[model samples]
Target: MRLTAEQIASFHEDGFLVLQDWFTPDEVDLLRTETYHEFGNDQPGRILEKNGAVRTVFAAHKSNDVFSRLTRLQKMAEPAAQLLGDEVYVHQFKINAKLGLDGDQWEWHQDYLYWLKEDAMPTPNVLSAVVFLNTVDDFNGPLLLIPGSQKMGTIDLDVEKKYQQLDVAESWKPTLTADLKYKISKRTLIRALENSRIVAAKGTPGFVVFFHGNTLHASAGNLSPVDRLSVFISYNTVANALQPIANPRPTFISERDFTPIAALPDDALLAPRNGHSSPQREQLASLAG
Candidate 1:
Protein backbone atom coordinates (compact mmCIF):
# COMPACT_ATOMS: atom_id res chain seq x y z
CA MET A 1 0.00 0.00 0.00
CA ARG A 2 1.16 3.51 -0.75
CA LEU A 3 1.76 5.80 2.20
CA THR A 4 -0.22 9.03 2.17
CA ALA A 5 1.40 12.43 2.55
CA GLU A 6 -0.30 12.78 5.92
CA GLN A 7 1.14 9.49 7.13
CA ILE A 8 4.55 10.48 5.90
CA ALA A 9 4.28 13.82 7.64
CA SER A 10 3.15 12.14 10.82
CA PHE A 11 6.20 9.94 10.69
CA HIS A 12 8.47 12.89 10.08
CA GLU A 13 6.87 14.89 12.85
CA ASP A 14 6.61 12.16 15.45
CA GLY A 15 9.41 9.83 14.37
CA PHE A 16 6.98 6.90 14.20
CA LEU A 17 3.93 5.59 12.31
CA VAL A 18 1.52 2.83 13.18
CA LEU A 19 -0.02 1.18 10.12
CA GLN A 20 -3.06 -0.97 10.77
CA ASP A 21 -3.25 -4.35 9.04
CA TRP A 22 -0.01 -3.83 7.16
CA PHE A 23 0.29 -7.63 6.84
CA THR A 24 -2.36 -10.12 5.84
CA PRO A 25 -4.07 -12.21 8.49
CA ASP A 26 -2.75 -15.41 6.94
CA GLU A 27 0.77 -14.11 7.04
CA VAL A 28 0.45 -13.09 10.66
CA ASP A 29 -0.87 -16.51 11.61
CA LEU A 30 1.98 -18.22 9.88
CA LEU A 31 4.54 -16.17 11.80
CA ARG A 32 2.80 -16.70 15.11
CA THR A 33 2.57 -20.43 14.63
CA GLU A 34 6.20 -20.66 13.66
CA THR A 35 7.31 -18.63 16.62
CA TYR A 36 5.29 -20.67 19.14
CA HIS A 37 6.57 -23.89 17.66
CA GLU A 38 10.14 -22.74 17.92
CA PHE A 39 9.71 -21.53 21.45
CA GLY A 40 8.02 -24.74 22.57
CA ASN A 41 10.70 -26.92 21.03
CA ASP A 42 13.64 -24.79 22.16
CA GLN A 43 15.70 -25.13 18.98
CA PRO A 44 19.15 -23.63 18.38
CA GLY A 45 20.20 -24.03 22.01
CA ARG A 46 18.32 -20.95 23.10
CA ILE A 47 17.01 -20.27 26.59
CA LEU A 48 13.48 -19.52 27.85
CA GLU A 49 12.56 -17.41 30.87
CA LYS A 50 9.35 -17.36 32.84
CA ASN A 51 8.68 -14.67 35.40
CA GLY A 52 5.55 -15.60 37.30
CA ALA A 53 3.19 -16.43 34.44
CA VAL A 54 4.97 -14.54 31.63
CA ARG A 55 7.26 -16.51 29.38
CA THR A 56 9.72 -15.31 26.76
CA VAL A 57 12.11 -16.79 24.22
CA PHE A 58 14.98 -15.17 22.25
CA ALA A 59 16.70 -16.03 18.97
CA ALA A 60 19.01 -14.58 16.32
CA HIS A 61 19.10 -14.29 12.54
CA LYS A 62 20.10 -17.06 10.06
CA SER A 63 18.50 -19.52 12.46
CA ASN A 64 14.79 -19.14 11.77
CA ASP A 65 12.35 -18.66 8.90
CA VAL A 66 10.39 -15.97 10.81
CA PHE A 67 13.36 -13.62 10.84
CA SER A 68 14.13 -14.51 7.21
CA ARG A 69 10.59 -13.63 6.12
CA LEU A 70 10.58 -10.40 8.16
CA THR A 71 13.87 -9.25 6.68
CA ARG A 72 12.71 -10.07 3.14
CA LEU A 73 9.14 -8.77 3.33
CA GLN A 74 8.39 -6.30 0.54
CA LYS A 75 5.99 -4.45 2.84
CA MET A 76 8.97 -3.53 4.99
CA ALA A 77 11.42 -3.08 2.11
CA GLU A 78 9.17 -0.76 0.13
CA PRO A 79 8.63 1.83 2.84
CA ALA A 80 12.27 1.52 3.82
CA ALA A 81 13.22 2.40 0.26
CA GLN A 82 11.03 5.47 0.44
CA LEU A 83 12.45 6.51 3.80
CA LEU A 84 16.09 5.85 2.99
CA GLY A 85 15.86 6.84 -0.73
CA ASP A 86 18.20 4.02 -1.73
CA GLU A 87 18.96 0.40 -1.18
CA VAL A 88 18.89 -0.66 2.43
CA TYR A 89 20.39 -3.46 4.48
CA VAL A 90 19.15 -5.34 7.54
CA HIS A 91 21.25 -4.41 10.54
CA GLN A 92 19.47 -6.53 13.17
CA PHE A 93 16.33 -8.63 13.59
CA LYS A 94 14.66 -10.46 16.49
CA ILE A 95 11.47 -11.99 17.88
CA ASN A 96 10.38 -10.91 21.36
CA ALA A 97 7.56 -13.00 22.86
CA LYS A 98 6.01 -12.01 26.19
CA LEU A 99 3.61 -14.63 27.33
CA GLY A 100 1.44 -14.83 30.46
CA LEU A 101 1.35 -12.29 33.31
CA ASP A 102 4.94 -11.78 34.31
CA GLY A 103 6.73 -10.06 31.45
CA ASP A 104 9.15 -7.34 32.49
CA GLN A 105 8.77 -3.72 31.48
CA TRP A 106 11.06 -2.09 28.92
CA GLU A 107 12.57 1.28 29.80
CA TRP A 108 12.24 4.24 27.47
CA HIS A 109 15.40 4.98 25.49
CA GLN A 110 16.84 5.53 22.04
CA ASP A 111 18.07 2.25 20.64
CA TYR A 112 21.24 3.84 19.28
CA LEU A 113 22.25 4.87 22.78
CA TYR A 114 23.09 1.24 23.40
CA TRP A 115 25.31 1.26 20.32
CA LEU A 116 27.04 4.60 20.73
CA LYS A 117 30.61 4.70 21.95
CA GLU A 118 32.76 7.67 23.01
CA ASP A 119 31.43 10.93 21.49
CA ALA A 120 30.23 10.30 17.95
CA MET A 121 27.59 11.74 15.67
CA PRO A 122 24.56 9.46 15.77
CA THR A 123 23.73 7.82 12.48
CA PRO A 124 20.51 9.07 10.85
CA ASN A 125 19.90 6.36 8.27
CA VAL A 126 18.58 3.79 10.68
CA LEU A 127 14.93 2.77 11.22
CA SER A 128 13.12 -0.12 12.88
CA ALA A 129 9.93 -2.06 12.12
CA VAL A 130 8.07 -3.75 14.97
CA VAL A 131 5.52 -6.21 13.59
CA PHE A 132 2.94 -7.33 16.07
CA LEU A 133 2.21 -11.01 15.74
CA ASN A 134 -0.46 -10.81 18.41
CA THR A 135 -2.72 -8.18 19.89
CA VAL A 136 -1.01 -5.80 22.36
CA ASP A 137 -2.69 -3.92 25.17
CA ASP A 138 -2.02 -2.41 28.57
CA PHE A 139 -2.20 -5.76 30.33
CA ASN A 140 0.08 -7.32 27.78
CA GLY A 141 2.49 -4.41 27.74
CA PRO A 142 1.74 -2.31 24.67
CA LEU A 143 4.51 -0.06 23.41
CA LEU A 144 4.69 3.62 24.46
CA LEU A 145 6.35 6.32 22.40
CA ILE A 146 7.17 10.00 22.85
CA PRO A 147 6.31 11.95 19.74
CA GLY A 148 9.04 14.15 18.16
CA SER A 149 11.58 12.88 20.63
CA GLN A 150 13.81 11.48 17.91
CA LYS A 151 14.77 15.02 16.94
CA MET A 152 16.47 15.38 20.31
CA GLY A 153 19.33 13.27 18.95
CA THR A 154 21.48 11.19 21.26
CA ILE A 155 21.20 11.69 24.98
CA ASP A 156 23.60 14.42 26.07
CA LEU A 157 26.19 13.36 28.64
CA ASP A 158 25.23 16.32 30.78
CA VAL A 159 21.56 15.42 30.63
CA GLU A 160 22.42 11.92 31.66
CA LYS A 161 24.39 13.27 34.62
CA LYS A 162 21.40 15.33 35.73
CA TYR A 163 19.16 12.31 35.46
CA GLN A 164 21.51 10.43 37.72
CA GLN A 165 21.23 13.12 40.30
CA LEU A 166 17.46 12.98 40.15
CA ASP A 167 17.52 9.23 40.49
CA VAL A 168 19.67 9.50 43.58
CA ALA A 169 17.45 12.17 45.08
CA GLU A 170 14.35 10.04 44.50
CA SER A 171 16.14 7.04 45.98
CA TRP A 172 15.09 5.11 42.95
CA LYS A 173 17.16 2.21 41.73
CA PRO A 174 15.27 0.69 38.83
CA THR A 175 17.54 -2.24 38.24
CA LEU A 176 20.15 -3.74 40.50
CA THR A 177 23.21 -2.57 38.56
CA ALA A 178 24.78 0.57 37.11
CA ASP A 179 24.47 -0.81 33.59
CA LEU A 180 20.69 -0.53 33.91
CA LYS A 181 20.96 3.09 35.09
CA TYR A 182 21.03 4.37 31.53
CA LYS A 183 17.73 2.64 30.81
CA ILE A 184 16.28 4.13 33.97
CA SER A 185 17.39 7.56 32.88
CA LYS A 186 15.57 7.08 29.63
CA ARG A 187 12.36 6.25 31.46
CA THR A 188 12.76 9.38 33.56
CA LEU A 189 13.18 11.47 30.43
CA ILE A 190 10.04 10.07 28.82
CA ARG A 191 8.07 10.49 32.04
CA ALA A 192 8.96 14.16 31.95
CA LEU A 193 7.03 14.52 28.69
CA GLU A 194 3.69 16.30 29.10
CA ASN A 195 1.90 14.56 26.22
CA SER A 196 3.06 10.98 26.49
CA ARG A 197 0.51 8.25 25.93
CA ILE A 198 0.41 4.48 25.88
CA VAL A 199 0.38 3.17 22.31
CA ALA A 200 -3.14 1.70 21.89
CA ALA A 201 -2.09 -1.02 19.45
CA LYS A 202 -4.13 -4.19 19.74
CA GLY A 203 -6.50 -6.29 17.62
CA THR A 204 -5.59 -7.83 14.27
CA PRO A 205 -2.15 -9.24 13.76
CA GLY A 206 0.36 -8.26 11.09
CA PHE A 207 0.12 -4.60 12.09
CA VAL A 208 3.53 -3.04 11.48
CA VAL A 209 4.91 -0.08 13.42
CA PHE A 210 7.86 1.88 12.09
CA PHE A 211 9.95 4.28 14.13
CA HIS A 212 13.16 6.23 13.80
CA GLY A 213 16.13 4.62 15.45
CA ASN A 214 16.36 7.48 17.94
CA THR A 215 12.69 7.45 18.95
CA LEU A 216 12.00 7.05 22.66
CA HIS A 217 9.88 3.95 23.11
CA ALA A 218 9.24 1.33 25.78
CA SER A 219 6.61 -1.06 27.19
CA ALA A 220 5.07 -1.96 30.56
CA GLY A 221 5.16 -5.39 32.12
CA ASN A 222 2.77 -7.97 30.73
CA LEU A 223 -0.05 -8.89 33.11
CA SER A 224 -2.25 -11.02 30.93
CA PRO A 225 -2.48 -14.71 30.18
CA VAL A 226 -2.44 -14.11 26.45
CA ASP A 227 0.94 -13.71 24.75
CA ARG A 228 2.45 -10.63 23.14
CA LEU A 229 4.87 -11.35 20.33
CA SER A 230 6.60 -8.89 18.03
CA VAL A 231 9.17 -9.20 15.31
CA PHE A 232 11.60 -6.25 15.38
CA ILE A 233 13.80 -5.59 12.35
CA SER A 234 16.48 -2.89 12.21
CA TYR A 235 17.19 -1.32 8.79
CA ASN A 236 19.71 1.16 7.47
CA THR A 237 20.23 3.00 4.19
CA VAL A 238 23.07 1.95 1.91
CA ALA A 239 24.71 5.36 2.31
CA ASN A 240 25.44 4.65 5.96
CA ALA A 241 27.93 1.99 7.01
CA LEU A 242 27.72 0.00 10.23
CA GLN A 243 30.70 0.50 12.50
CA PRO A 244 32.11 -2.35 14.57
CA ILE A 245 33.42 -1.66 18.03
CA ALA A 246 34.07 -3.54 21.21
CA ASN A 247 32.05 -2.96 24.35
CA PRO A 248 33.39 0.12 26.10
CA ARG A 249 30.88 0.27 28.96
CA PRO A 250 32.03 -0.53 32.45
CA THR A 251 29.23 -3.01 33.02
CA PHE A 252 28.49 -6.30 31.31
CA ILE A 253 26.06 -6.02 28.39
CA SER A 254 24.39 -8.44 25.99
CA GLU A 255 24.40 -6.50 22.70
CA ARG A 256 27.23 -6.33 20.14
CA ASP A 257 28.33 -3.85 17.47
CA PHE A 258 27.13 -4.43 13.90
CA THR A 259 29.48 -4.27 10.91
CA PRO A 260 28.78 -3.56 7.25
CA ILE A 261 28.68 -6.29 4.66
CA ALA A 262 32.02 -6.80 2.96
CA ALA A 263 30.97 -8.26 -0.37
CA LEU A 264 27.96 -9.73 -2.17
CA PRO A 265 27.49 -12.60 -4.55
CA ASP A 266 25.16 -12.11 -7.52
CA ASP A 267 22.50 -14.40 -5.99
CA ALA A 268 22.66 -12.77 -2.60
CA LEU A 269 19.40 -11.11 -1.58
CA LEU A 270 20.99 -8.25 0.37
CA ALA A 271 23.60 -6.01 -1.25
CA PRO A 272 26.99 -6.23 0.40
CA ARG A 273 28.55 -3.46 2.41
CA ASN A 274 31.84 -3.72 4.33
CA GLY A 275 30.57 -5.33 7.54
CA HIS A 276 29.76 -8.71 9.06
CA SER A 277 27.03 -10.33 11.17
CA SER A 278 26.52 -9.33 14.81
CA PRO A 279 25.83 -11.68 17.69
CA GLN A 280 22.31 -10.26 18.07
CA ARG A 281 21.49 -11.38 14.52
CA GLU A 282 22.54 -14.88 15.40
CA GLN A 283 20.30 -14.85 18.47
CA LEU A 284 17.33 -13.57 16.47
CA ALA A 285 17.71 -16.31 13.89
CA SER A 286 17.93 -18.95 16.53
CA LEU A 287 14.66 -17.78 18.09
CA ALA A 288 12.86 -17.40 14.79
CA GLY A 289 13.59 -20.97 13.78
Candidate 2:
Protein backbone atom coordinates (compact mmCIF):
# COMPACT_ATOMS: atom_id res chain seq x y z
CA MET A 1 0.00 0.00 0.00
CA ARG A 2 3.02 2.28 0.33
CA LEU A 3 4.08 4.54 -2.54
CA THR A 4 7.51 4.09 -4.15
CA ALA A 5 10.27 6.71 -4.21
CA GLU A 6 9.58 7.41 -7.89
CA GLN A 7 5.85 7.69 -7.25
CA ILE A 8 6.48 10.12 -4.41
CA ALA A 9 8.66 12.22 -6.69
CA SER A 10 5.94 12.28 -9.33
CA PHE A 11 3.40 13.41 -6.74
CA HIS A 12 5.71 16.21 -5.65
CA GLU A 13 6.16 17.34 -9.25
CA ASP A 14 2.58 16.92 -10.50
CA GLY A 15 0.66 17.64 -7.23
CA PHE A 16 -1.49 14.54 -7.87
CA LEU A 17 -1.35 10.77 -8.36
CA VAL A 18 -3.78 8.18 -9.70
CA LEU A 19 -4.01 4.58 -8.48
CA GLN A 20 -6.25 2.46 -10.66
CA ASP A 21 -8.34 -0.37 -9.19
CA TRP A 22 -7.19 0.33 -5.70
CA PHE A 23 -10.32 -1.42 -4.32
CA THR A 24 -11.75 -4.74 -5.39
CA PRO A 25 -15.11 -4.96 -7.18
CA ASP A 26 -16.74 -6.62 -4.12
CA GLU A 27 -15.45 -3.91 -1.80
CA VAL A 28 -16.63 -1.23 -4.19
CA ASP A 29 -20.07 -2.80 -4.30
CA LEU A 30 -20.29 -2.66 -0.51
CA LEU A 31 -19.16 0.98 -0.47
CA ARG A 32 -21.59 1.90 -3.24
CA THR A 33 -24.47 0.36 -1.30
CA GLU A 34 -23.53 2.27 1.85
CA THR A 35 -23.18 5.57 -0.02
CA TYR A 36 -26.67 5.42 -1.54
CA HIS A 37 -28.16 4.90 1.92
CA GLU A 38 -27.01 8.38 2.94
CA PHE A 39 -29.06 10.22 0.33
CA GLY A 40 -32.74 11.22 0.87
CA ASN A 41 -32.28 11.07 4.61
CA ASP A 42 -32.76 13.52 7.49
CA GLN A 43 -29.08 14.14 8.10
CA PRO A 44 -28.10 17.79 8.27
CA GLY A 45 -24.96 16.95 6.24
CA ARG A 46 -26.88 16.03 3.09
CA ILE A 47 -26.65 18.84 0.52
CA LEU A 48 -28.86 19.09 -2.54
CA GLU A 49 -28.58 20.83 -5.86
CA LYS A 50 -31.04 23.36 -7.28
CA ASN A 51 -32.55 20.58 -9.34
CA GLY A 52 -33.37 18.61 -6.16
CA ALA A 53 -30.69 15.99 -6.86
CA VAL A 54 -28.18 15.18 -4.16
CA ARG A 55 -24.93 17.13 -4.49
CA THR A 56 -22.88 16.06 -1.48
CA VAL A 57 -23.17 14.10 1.76
CA PHE A 58 -20.83 15.21 4.51
CA ALA A 59 -19.61 13.08 7.44
CA ALA A 60 -20.80 9.74 6.13
CA HIS A 61 -17.95 8.15 8.08
CA LYS A 62 -19.52 9.40 11.27
CA SER A 63 -22.92 7.88 10.60
CA ASN A 64 -22.33 4.62 8.71
CA ASP A 65 -20.32 1.59 9.89
CA VAL A 66 -18.83 0.83 6.48
CA PHE A 67 -17.63 4.39 5.91
CA SER A 68 -16.28 4.60 9.43
CA ARG A 69 -13.97 1.72 8.55
CA LEU A 70 -13.17 3.33 5.18
CA THR A 71 -11.60 6.31 6.93
CA ARG A 72 -8.84 4.08 8.30
CA LEU A 73 -8.00 2.02 5.22
CA GLN A 74 -4.25 1.37 5.07
CA LYS A 75 -4.14 2.02 1.32
CA MET A 76 -5.36 5.61 1.86
CA ALA A 77 -4.13 6.70 5.30
CA GLU A 78 -0.60 5.27 4.94
CA PRO A 79 0.15 7.08 1.69
CA ALA A 80 -1.29 10.32 3.10
CA ALA A 81 1.02 10.16 6.12
CA GLN A 82 3.94 9.50 3.77
CA LEU A 83 3.09 12.43 1.49
CA LEU A 84 2.55 14.93 4.28
CA GLY A 85 5.47 13.58 6.32
CA ASP A 86 3.50 14.03 9.50
CA GLU A 87 0.78 12.39 11.53
CA VAL A 88 -2.45 13.10 9.68
CA TYR A 89 -6.05 13.48 10.86
CA VAL A 90 -9.33 13.79 9.07
CA HIS A 91 -10.10 17.40 8.18
CA GLN A 92 -13.27 16.63 6.24
CA PHE A 93 -15.03 13.62 4.73
CA LYS A 94 -17.79 13.69 2.12
CA ILE A 95 -19.19 12.01 -0.98
CA ASN A 96 -19.87 14.10 -4.07
CA ALA A 97 -22.86 12.85 -6.07
CA LYS A 98 -23.23 14.03 -9.64
CA LEU A 99 -26.46 12.36 -10.69
CA GLY A 100 -27.25 11.43 -14.28
CA LEU A 101 -28.51 14.36 -16.41
CA ASP A 102 -29.30 16.34 -13.27
CA GLY A 103 -25.75 16.99 -12.23
CA ASP A 104 -24.34 20.53 -12.11
CA GLN A 105 -20.94 21.97 -12.86
CA TRP A 106 -18.36 22.71 -10.17
CA GLU A 107 -16.32 25.86 -10.82
CA TRP A 108 -12.52 25.83 -10.80
CA HIS A 109 -11.02 26.51 -7.38
CA GLN A 110 -8.35 25.47 -4.87
CA ASP A 111 -9.66 23.50 -1.86
CA TYR A 112 -7.16 25.13 0.51
CA LEU A 113 -8.77 28.54 -0.01
CA TYR A 114 -11.88 27.41 1.84
CA TRP A 115 -9.84 25.73 4.58
CA LEU A 116 -7.64 28.80 5.03
CA LYS A 117 -10.46 31.33 5.11
CA GLU A 118 -13.14 29.31 6.88
CA ASP A 119 -11.16 27.13 9.27
CA ALA A 120 -8.10 29.36 9.70
CA MET A 121 -5.78 26.63 8.48
CA PRO A 122 -2.15 27.77 8.77
CA THR A 123 -0.64 25.94 5.80
CA PRO A 124 -1.48 24.00 2.64
CA ASN A 125 -0.16 20.73 4.03
CA VAL A 126 -3.43 18.87 3.48
CA LEU A 127 -4.48 16.48 0.72
CA SER A 128 -7.58 14.64 -0.46
CA ALA A 129 -7.71 10.86 -1.02
CA VAL A 130 -10.67 10.20 -3.28
CA VAL A 131 -12.35 6.86 -4.16
CA PHE A 132 -14.55 6.55 -7.19
CA LEU A 133 -17.78 4.59 -6.55
CA ASN A 134 -18.78 4.55 -10.21
CA THR A 135 -17.06 4.64 -13.58
CA VAL A 136 -15.93 8.17 -14.42
CA ASP A 137 -15.63 8.93 -18.14
CA ASP A 138 -15.67 11.98 -20.42
CA PHE A 139 -19.46 11.94 -20.61
CA ASN A 140 -19.95 11.31 -16.88
CA GLY A 141 -18.30 14.46 -15.55
CA PRO A 142 -14.81 13.34 -14.61
CA LEU A 143 -12.65 15.59 -12.45
CA LEU A 144 -10.32 18.01 -14.29
CA LEU A 145 -7.03 18.87 -12.65
CA ILE A 146 -4.33 21.36 -13.59
CA PRO A 147 -0.90 19.74 -13.51
CA GLY A 148 1.74 21.53 -11.36
CA SER A 149 -0.78 24.16 -10.24
CA GLN A 150 -0.15 23.37 -6.58
CA LYS A 151 3.32 24.89 -6.85
CA MET A 152 1.74 28.28 -7.64
CA GLY A 153 0.96 28.61 -3.94
CA THR A 154 -2.42 30.00 -2.94
CA ILE A 155 -4.14 32.07 -5.60
CA ASP A 156 -5.53 35.44 -4.59
CA LEU A 157 -9.30 35.30 -4.90
CA ASP A 158 -11.88 37.99 -4.14
CA VAL A 159 -14.45 35.88 -2.30
CA GLU A 160 -16.11 38.65 -0.31
CA LYS A 161 -16.80 40.89 -3.30
CA LYS A 162 -18.52 38.16 -5.33
CA TYR A 163 -21.06 37.40 -2.60
CA GLN A 164 -21.46 40.96 -1.32
CA GLN A 165 -25.05 41.04 -2.44
CA LEU A 166 -25.97 37.98 -0.37
CA ASP A 167 -26.58 38.02 3.35
CA VAL A 168 -23.60 37.20 5.51
CA ALA A 169 -25.71 34.92 7.68
CA GLU A 170 -26.20 32.49 4.78
CA SER A 171 -23.07 33.14 2.74
CA TRP A 172 -21.29 30.03 4.01
CA LYS A 173 -23.84 27.69 2.47
CA PRO A 174 -23.32 29.04 -1.06
CA THR A 175 -19.65 28.16 -1.05
CA LEU A 176 -20.53 24.45 -0.93
CA THR A 177 -22.87 24.62 -3.89
CA ALA A 178 -22.25 23.77 -7.55
CA ASP A 179 -21.18 27.36 -8.25
CA LEU A 180 -18.51 27.90 -5.63
CA LYS A 181 -18.36 31.28 -3.91
CA TYR A 182 -14.55 31.23 -3.90
CA LYS A 183 -14.25 30.35 -7.57
CA ILE A 184 -11.04 31.12 -9.42
CA SER A 185 -11.62 33.89 -11.94
CA LYS A 186 -11.21 33.38 -15.68
CA ARG A 187 -8.24 35.77 -15.85
CA THR A 188 -6.41 33.78 -13.21
CA LEU A 189 -7.37 30.46 -14.82
CA ILE A 190 -5.96 31.61 -18.16
CA ARG A 191 -2.73 32.60 -16.47
CA ALA A 192 -2.58 29.17 -14.82
CA LEU A 193 -3.17 27.35 -18.11
CA GLU A 194 -0.20 29.15 -19.63
CA ASN A 195 2.06 27.16 -17.34
CA SER A 196 0.08 23.92 -16.93
CA ARG A 197 -2.39 21.83 -18.87
CA ILE A 198 -5.65 20.27 -17.68
CA VAL A 199 -6.08 16.49 -17.41
CA ALA A 200 -9.29 14.48 -16.99
CA ALA A 201 -9.37 11.86 -14.22
CA LYS A 202 -11.22 9.01 -15.85
CA GLY A 203 -11.41 5.57 -14.26
CA THR A 204 -13.56 2.66 -13.04
CA PRO A 205 -15.31 2.10 -9.68
CA GLY A 206 -12.15 1.21 -7.75
CA PHE A 207 -10.04 4.13 -9.01
CA VAL A 208 -8.36 6.36 -6.45
CA VAL A 209 -6.75 9.79 -6.86
CA PHE A 210 -4.70 11.71 -4.35
CA PHE A 211 -4.34 15.45 -4.92
CA HIS A 212 -2.70 18.22 -2.93
CA GLY A 213 -4.85 20.73 -1.08
CA ASN A 214 -3.65 23.58 -3.26
CA THR A 215 -4.29 21.80 -6.54
CA LEU A 216 -6.61 23.77 -8.86
CA HIS A 217 -9.41 21.54 -10.14
CA ALA A 218 -13.04 21.40 -11.30
CA SER A 219 -15.57 19.27 -13.14
CA ALA A 220 -18.25 19.75 -15.80
CA GLY A 221 -21.88 18.64 -15.48
CA ASN A 222 -22.78 15.04 -16.23
CA LEU A 223 -24.29 14.80 -19.74
CA SER A 224 -24.72 11.05 -20.02
CA PRO A 225 -27.26 8.92 -18.19
CA VAL A 226 -24.85 7.76 -15.50
CA ASP A 227 -24.04 8.85 -11.97
CA ARG A 228 -20.58 9.97 -10.84
CA LEU A 229 -20.19 9.24 -7.12
CA SER A 230 -16.86 9.73 -5.43
CA VAL A 231 -15.75 9.68 -1.80
CA PHE A 232 -13.35 12.39 -0.56
CA ILE A 233 -11.36 12.17 2.63
CA SER A 234 -9.27 15.27 3.37
CA TYR A 235 -6.32 14.61 5.64
CA ASN A 236 -4.43 17.42 7.37
CA THR A 237 -1.15 17.20 9.20
CA VAL A 238 -1.55 17.39 12.99
CA ALA A 239 0.97 20.25 13.03
CA ASN A 240 -1.18 22.13 10.54
CA ALA A 241 -4.53 21.71 12.32
CA LEU A 242 -6.92 24.64 12.15
CA GLN A 243 -6.67 27.57 14.48
CA PRO A 244 -9.85 28.84 16.14
CA ILE A 245 -12.05 31.20 14.15
CA ALA A 246 -15.32 32.98 14.95
CA ASN A 247 -18.43 31.70 13.18
CA PRO A 248 -16.71 28.49 12.19
CA ARG A 249 -18.36 26.25 9.63
CA PRO A 250 -20.62 23.39 10.73
CA THR A 251 -18.83 20.44 12.35
CA PHE A 252 -19.97 18.08 9.59
CA ILE A 253 -18.05 20.08 6.97
CA SER A 254 -15.00 20.70 9.22
CA GLU A 255 -14.20 17.97 11.71
CA ARG A 256 -13.57 19.20 15.25
CA ASP A 257 -11.52 16.20 16.35
CA PHE A 258 -7.81 16.47 15.55
CA THR A 259 -6.81 12.95 16.50
CA PRO A 260 -4.30 11.28 14.21
CA ILE A 261 -5.73 8.44 12.12
CA ALA A 262 -4.66 4.87 12.95
CA ALA A 263 -5.07 2.77 9.82
CA LEU A 264 -6.61 -0.71 9.97
CA PRO A 265 -5.20 -3.90 8.40
CA ASP A 266 -4.87 -3.84 4.58
CA ASP A 267 -7.54 -6.55 4.23
CA ALA A 268 -10.00 -4.80 6.52
CA LEU A 269 -12.43 -4.03 3.71
CA LEU A 270 -12.42 -7.57 2.30
CA ALA A 271 -12.89 -9.24 5.66
CA PRO A 272 -15.89 -11.47 6.29
CA ARG A 273 -19.20 -9.70 6.74
CA ASN A 274 -19.85 -11.71 9.91
CA GLY A 275 -17.56 -12.07 12.90
CA HIS A 276 -15.93 -15.43 11.96
CA SER A 277 -17.71 -16.85 8.94
CA SER A 278 -18.16 -16.20 5.22
CA PRO A 279 -21.14 -14.11 4.06
CA GLN A 280 -23.06 -17.17 2.83
CA ARG A 281 -22.45 -19.06 6.05
CA GLU A 282 -23.63 -16.09 8.09
CA GLN A 283 -26.80 -15.86 5.99
CA LEU A 284 -27.56 -19.54 6.43
CA ALA A 285 -26.98 -19.35 10.19
CA SER A 286 -29.38 -16.42 10.42
CA LEU A 287 -32.05 -18.52 8.65
CA ALA A 288 -31.45 -21.42 11.03
CA GLY A 289 -31.81 -19.15 14.02
**Could you say which candidate leads in lDDT?**
2
Which stretch of 10 consecutive residues in model 2 shows the poorest summed lDDT?
280-289
The sequence of per-residue lDDT tens digits that candidate 2 reaches over residues 80-160 is 999999988889999998999988999999999999987899999999999998999999899999999999999867766
Report lDDT per candidate. 0.60, 0.87
lDDT of 1 by residue, 159-246 (tens): 3564456533232222211233455364557454756544555556778888887788777767899788887777776566444434
Error of 2 at 132 (Å): 0.6
The TM-score of candidate 1 is 0.70
Which sections of candidate 2 miss by over 4 Å?
160-169, 272-289
| Position 182, candidate 1: lDDT | 51
Q: Return the TM-score for each candidate structure.
A: 0.70, 0.92
- For each of the candidates, give the backbone clash count: 19, 0
